[model samples]
Target: MAIEIENKDQQHPRAKKDGEVVERLLQESANDNNLAEVARLRIRYGGFPGARSMQRNLDIVLERWNLTEEGLFELTRQIHAEGRAYKRNSNGEEQEDWT
Candidate 1:
């Protein structure tokens, strides 16, 4: 005899979308040469279930990396641009719009 199990609560569609976004961001972070920024990204979203976790993580990463908030913002901006170029070419818009 065999038993079967199932999840009681399925993830919402928005949660799934959020997970995809996080995965993409992590993938971008993983490719960077900057270890400190990678650590910051992990701390920001690596399944830490705590109150004010993001704030605490930001503080730690900034101090450890000696980076100002603007530096962090710039780092994230570069990371976010890594894979977004494809979106410009294949956004389901009219072909004429791409020319």
Candidate 2:
């Protein structure tokens, strides 16, 4: 498990009791390589009820995992260009543009 080496005693206690659950959601999402979903859920449940941890760590995770908004956008663009994540709808909206 990942933990702050300096905070092994849990002295920091930066997160709420329920924070671990939310973090678990993020961790499981990350474990499955669903960084996009992780980011999205952080935006969704993060601002909704039942959320414990603040959304700031999304940036931390992104920075730690080297995931940035620009990076994800470029990745989406590339995937779309490669026909891996783009399907034009009947309307002008995008089918599955995660960015």
TM-score of each: 0.32, 0.36
- Candidate 1 per-residue C-alpha lDDT over 9-43 given as tens digits, one digit per residue, 9 for 90 to 100: 44333344434444444444333434333344444
Candidate 1 local distance difference test against the native: 0.45
Question: Over the stretch 1-99, how does candidate 2's per-residue lDDT look in tens digits?
Answer: 887555232322324533554465545433322444444445444444333334555555566666776775555555546655534578955544233
Q: What is the lDDT of residue 84 in candidate 1?
A: 27
Lowest summed lDDT window (length 10), candidate 2: 6-15
Where model 1 places Cα greater than 4 Å from the true spot, the runs are 1-50, 84-99
The 0-to-1 C-alpha lDDT of every candidate, in the order given, reads 0.45, 0.49
Q: Over all chains combined, what TM-score does candidate 2 have?
A: 0.36
Q: Identify the candidate with maximal lDDT.
A: 2
Q: After superposition, how far is residue 5 of candidate 2 from its true place, in Å?
A: 43
